[model samples]
Target chain A: MTALIDIKDVSHTFATDGGPLHVLDHLNISIEEGGFTAVVGPSGCGKSTLTRLVSGLMKPDEGEVWLHGERVKGPRSTVGMAFQNPVLLEWRTILDNVILPLEIVPNKLSRAERVDRAEFLLGLVGLTGFEDKKPSELSGGMRQRASLCRALVHKPEVLILDEPFGALDAFTREDLWQTMHKVKSEEPFTGLLITHDLRESIFLADQVVVMSGRPAHAQYIMDVPSTGERVIDDLYTPDSAERLNILRHQIQIAQGREPADVEAAQ
Target chain B: MSLKKIAIPTIAVIIFLLLWELLVWANGWPNFVMASPSDLGPAYVRYWDLFLINGWQTLWRTVAGLALAIVFGTALGMIMGFSKVMRDALYPLLVGFNAIPKATVVPIIALMFVGAHDFNTVLIAFMISFFPIAVSVSIGLSTLEPEYRDILRSLGASKMTIFWKIALPKTLPEFFGALKVAVTLAFIGTNLMEIVSPHGRGLGALFDSGRTNSDYPLMFAVLIALAFLGIVLYYVVVVLEKIFAGWAERQET
Candidate 1:
């Protein structure tokens, strides 16, 4: 498969009162077309920064980020993003929030067509009847689902998720993972998800990229078997546990803790 | 359904007014010194047409000044909010202008446009009402969520598109809030102008004439008219606010 996104030796640093703080250090990554990739790391490991760079919200201090053979200079409309916080506009109803991108992109579709598209996306996310409710009226999981609908409404080539389900409970998070998987199956697109949840990464991704601590660079790339269906039972298998252990170990080592000791503590 | 809530305030006002009328009548005060409600009622009815005519003049000036202020102040405020360079350049000047009491400049305005005929009064009204709107709008636009800004940026929205779609809509509530205050200031400013330069007939001119000739009843009538006009204009803004900002209000509640 051809690369949909290419990050070549990208590094980022921010100036601080004490000194320069390095975030990403010469990170090289490439995402294949129609692939689902998850990036996992401990907190402050620059995982979110990686998504921001791919989405063209921030430029790498050194090196290049290319999307579909073009250098990423600024925000790219072809990319859609959802955050951990859901970030829905409070004043807008769920339907309006889902259709927000279309409102900004005038003449993209007729008014009737836009409404149909918004309804279709809302239905896909199981938010059909809650369309007219404001964000404040919805649960955290529902809000994030609405946000997901919003991100997909524009039908962008690449979807960037920055821990979109991090704020939800375990049951809700599992349910949304399946919902996301179902949505992915219906509308296949290149996805880059930055998350700390190893099970989420293993279950949803075609490939999982692990990163080291701050001044983070790609540390390991693990390919998840293309199993057609994943259930909670699959998580009990020795292979699944091994994969999870590897990721857990990598995170511990990156955070300056001895992996053996961390594992013992756990 | 909530008759008790409504009745308590109504009863209090009636009792207060009755006591005032009794006190004025019992003391045998001069009519010019303090006109009772009974005395003022007939006076108000007799001069209702004149009061309305003057009230209309004041109302027109206040509304016109407010409209002009909304246009200029909202635009300037949005610019200041969106651009640091604009804020740095224009903010201090705005502060300096605001620092000078608008009332103190009425004489200067009158002297400058003595024969200009109603021009100075409208200008003074605009000056006084404009600042609050500009300040409120700037604050509102500047305080938008970073996430929303990010969304716009990622969508490749142009600066003008961002302003019109995001900034302008977000500032509507604050703009209306400032407008509520500006309406009252517009009334005060227009009245001040009329007092300083009484060319055309307005509430302020009526007030000045009544005070000069000791027409206490007429003075009371103008005050009543001013109160009614101010209340009416304020409610108009409130209604518009409810219509325009219904979505935001729903979110708040």
Candidate 2:
């Protein structure tokens, strides 16, 4: 069966004053419909580049991106994205910000239905009372929560999130993880996460793909030990810790920081 | 807090005026050479009618010229902002116009366009003020955050949609900010035109007449009038910004 988003042998080069900088080389990823996948790499690796490529926000120089088995020629409305910074337009109130995607993307839904969906999604993220407040009035976590609602309000088939919780504190990040996961399971959209947090990957994704440094390609993929259902606490187990260690070891090797990391850990 | 915002400026102005009066009195200059603060009150009372008429005329002409510039300038700015070809073609021309001293062009406009007093003044004001507005708007549109734009495009928004929803609203605060500078430029443009050309009752001519008549107090009065006009115009821009672009004031994430 065709995956919801398929990236085939994609490579990208950014022209700089120095020369052409290769960011991704022969990168391939397939996200099955309704499955959550996480991509982890070093800080400067091309994980975010892959996120943009799959969302159809950009073109890969060497390969094509496919959505539902069709080649993506330009940006696609079937994908929704959130970033580390919520990027809510300050002028817009929370409710208006969440309604932004629906306003931009054409749909047969009436304005009332759109508002209803925005409100419903906002409520889902536990931001119901603060809808009337401006983005400036909210905390960072609340702003990110509002951004998540904005992304999901349109009900896109695929969701691309680039380190959306990386800026938050540990507790806020974990809280949002619970909120996001609960919302995703209920809505059942394919999710792609670009992050470096190992425990975050373990708790949230069905599959965690490790990546190399610049000119990034997937180094390894690990199926989460607990596949059926997960709560944040489930990641505290010894087995989950072992899985985290394995993923961490692969990432360190891919990043070329600690080749003997595994043996060193013992 | 708001009271403090008002009181501090008011106190500063009073201190400045008092210091100026003391400096002039201590210098012991003759009244013909300069007017003291005491002389200003009588001078204003004597010339109140002239100031009112000329101030009204300047006000109308400034508004007319500024309105024309706003319409054409906004369209021009958007076109240049969206198209690199348009920006490149117009950039040199705008630079050349800016490089020329507007004062040099004022007399030529007066000599070539004889008898259309309104037209000459309006053109002068338009010429001086439009550059800042157009350039600011173009820059604002051109420099929009790429990440926000990606979000819009990923939603399949059209270029026109991107412009209205993102570019235009984002540019408004900058555009409004430019208007504050543009209003002062409009006053300067009007003064330049009125000095050389036939501005029937502008403050520029009134000040020139005071100079010719050796009426120092009258000159001071007209300067005061012009200063007041500047303050009023500046505040008008401020209030408009509050209504239209207030959201930009907050620095939240």
Candidate 3:
């Protein structure tokens, strides 16, 4: 099947104070129509550069990025993006913040329907009473949850989570993974997550694509074993543990910090 | 909101007033030489008409000049902040203009306007007091987080949309801060022009006369009136800050 999103033989260079920085070289990645794919890589591997390319915020110097069979040249309207920081507008109330996309992008829904959708999405994430609250009024995790609702409110064809849970506390992170899956099951959009955490990739992604160091490329690919519907308890299984372990070792080697590095440090 | 806010300043002013009264009394200085705090009342009654007319003139001039400054300053700031070329071209000019000693610039302004004293005064005020506000508003627009723009862009927001929804709303707190500062500078600009101009008719003129005649009560009285005007205008900006900038404050402060 033709992929919904495709990055084929893409290379990008950034000019910095030091010199030309070649961050991604001849990288290839693609996602099926409704797949949730996670990209895990070492720091400075140009993961964010990859995101910018896919989102059409920046064009790759070589090759091309195609979305739904069309080349992406500018910011795409049919995509939702969230970063590590919630990036909520402090001046706007929670409901206003969640519905901010609707305020900008052209929509066919009535104003009331827009508000209702925003309210319903907020409710889906257990934020029923925070409709009038400002982004600042919410806690960090709650703010991220609101951000998640915002990304989904317009019901885009794709959702990009660039380490969306990286900064949250461990418990909050774990809780949000469950929230992530729950939301995904209900709202089945293609998702692309860029993360450093191997377990997070294993838990949340249908397919995990790994990248090597700067001038990055797809170095490895792994699939989570088929489960009819994933639950929090399924994460406790030994098979999942094995997957996690192998993924960890793969990442360590790609990062050039293998068991030998650990032994030498010891 | 706290005893420190209201009580400390009041107590300090009272203490300063008492000390001034004691000094005048201790030296047995004449009212022309030095006036006691109590002398302000009768002296005010003596020049109440002059006070009202001149104070009104000064107050209105200050407001008019400041209002014009705000409009021009905000626009300039938004432009400079958004465009690197404009900023690079104008920033140095602005920095130089701001440094040129507005006190000296007033005479040249008076010369340019020739007979239009009021225009000259207002122009002086606008020129002197607009930098902080312009710099403030533009900085606010320019310094927005990269992610904020990216999120908006991903939603297919145009450059104008990002500006209207993000840049403008984000500048409120900084804009208000600049207004508060500009109000005080407005007073300075107006009064300085008034001081040097021969046809001085404002409290600044009264100050010039009091200085010439060494009329201590008259100088103190004009200062009191100017202080009242300054407080009122400053508070107007503060109230505006609360109304318009409350969201920004609640967001971060």
**RMSD vs true structure, all candidates:** 3.2, 2.8, 2.3
Number of the candidate with higher DockQ, 1 or 2: 2
Best-to-worst order by DockQ is 3, 2, 1
Q: TM-score ranking from best to worst?
A: 3, 2, 1
- For model 1, the DockQ equals 0.50
lDDT of 2 by residue, A143-205 (tens): 999999888888899888999999999999999888977797677788899887999998899
Residue pairs in steric clash, candidate 3? none
lDDT of 1 by residue, B18-111 (tens): 9988999899997798877777788778777877888888888888888889899988998889888998999999999989987789888778
- Candidate 3 chain B minimal-lDDT segment of 10 residues: B244-253
lDDT of each: 0.86, 0.86, 0.88
Model 1, TM vs. native: 0.89
Query: What is the per-residue lDDT of model 3 for residues B100-156, given as tens digits with 9 covering 90 to 100?
Result: 998888778878889998888888889989999999988998898999999999878
Instruction: Give me the displacement of residue A202 in model 2, in angstroms.
Output: 1.7
Which whole-number lDDT from 0 to 100 does residue B142 have in model 2?
81
Worst 10 residues of 1 chain B by lDDT: B244-253
Q: Considering lDDT, which of the candidate structures 1 and 3 is the better prediction for this target? A: 3
Best by TM-score: 3
Error of 3 at A174 (Å): 0.7
Q: Which regions of candidate 3 are displaced past 4 Å?
A: A226-229, A263-266, B1-16, B27-33, B250-253
lDDT, candidate 3, equals: 0.88
True contacts kept of 2: 0.81
Q: List the pairs of residues colliding in candidate 2.
A: none
